[model samples]
Target: MTYTFDIIGVTPIPKFVQFQHQFAKKPDRSKTYLGSYECSLDGLISATKMIPHKPNWDWDQVLEEIINFWVQSEESIQHWKKQLYTVREESLLVARVANSEALRQEFETLWQE
Candidate 1:
């Protein structure tokens, strides 16, 4: 599928970069939601700097790099999912342990009283 990228913002810092993938064929042109990447002020500035010397630069290479940096790979998504799951499991275990410890302390206090 073909896609287009748009930089959304008016101020010195752009809000984000939006990309839309073309899903429908021509004559019934339609775009589907791809994703957006929040742009940092420094990144925007650096990107602009690359544009000035464009005549001598490889535009295709530049586009490829930008897309690669913005797009999330399947492996990256899976890795992030695993990391989140591990964090959540650890947090739940810690909470359960803390709750049991608190209950034990309460029982001891009551028995002593």
Candidate 2:
């Protein structure tokens, strides 16, 4: 079964970031699992924004880089249990893009002040 990523609880402040892996075909809430990676708001913004600029990189490679970033930044890599967390490359890419765009808007407002 295919799976996708869902980003939740994102805020303007640097706080705990939570994401989930869920069956793509099934929208049921019960079919999903949650996972978290400790990262600063800046790190999250940078990683998600930077990946899209590399035109040569494929989605799989991009996903690998993101996974590596999470692992390296987190002290306990065990949190990334395979069964609970799986990255659907495209879904993550889309989520990151959307996230970055929202961040961009937020930042623009701050900058304009």
Candidate 3:
């Protein structure tokens, strides 16, 4: 999977079309937000079925990809200061919602650190 990074506060505008309008007002800079969004090249994917995401998808690999991308591309490390991990319980929530006992345990173990 390809990953892209956006440095908050460095650019007045964000690259993603979805974020461009939302960040227009410049919400609280101190708060950290992490999320995933879906867009289709062809219209069929979204029309056909809901995208199934694993409980730890964002917590594990996705977060690392985002951080790595930013680290490699950004000139200054300061932009990463506000990037925060989405709480560990969120992973447990996703696991419970997906009804995956193993995923729940994985999150529990990771959360202990």
Candidate 4:
């Protein structure tokens, strides 16, 4: 289930900015949420990048492609959404020292610019 997206990037992407504003400093949030959101956006961008610069694909195909993307993902967002469900299981009430350490390391390495 683990993947490359699990690791923070060396440079923060544009989506990460919005992710921070909405999900970063909130009662219901975690690095996994940000990571999942980033991956989802990345998938969209990556998909679009595959198309030729011109109108290689019609509008309907593009829309179909977008819908197919999530449908193809058997796991869907449940992987992360479920994590958000059980606040206790997610360690929402307590400080996750280990996770914080990893997240800090991620920010330091990724946001250095």
Shift of residue 68 alpha carbon in model 3, Å: 1.0
lDDT of the candidates, in the order given = 0.31, 0.34, 0.30, 0.36
TM-score of 2: 0.24
* Pairs that clash in candidate 4: none
lDDT of 3 by residue, 1-113 (tens): 22233433221113332343453244322112233221111221121122222222333343444446544754433323322223322211000011234435657888899
When 1 and 3 are scored with TM-score, the better candidate is 3
Model 2, 18-99: lDDT tens per residue?
2222223333222222223433333344444433123222345445545555556453333333312453321222223222
- Give the C-alpha miss distance for residue 85 in model 2, angstroms: 13
lDDT, candidate 3, at 71: 47
| Pairs of residues clashing in candidate 3 | none
Residue runs of model 3 more than 4 Å from their true location after superposition: 10-58, 78-113
- How do the candidates rank by lDDT, highest first? 4, 2, 1, 3
Give the root-mean-square deviation of each candidate in angstroms.
Answer: 23.8, 14.0, 18.4, 14.2
Candidate 3's TM-score: 0.24
Question: Per-residue lDDT for 1-113 in model 1, tens only?
Answer: 22233332221111112111122122222211112122332343245342221222334544544455446444543443354345422211000001233345657888998
Model 4: per-residue lDDT, tens digit, 1-113?
11112222322335544544454444322233222223353444343433222222244444454455446654644453444344342121111111344456667877787
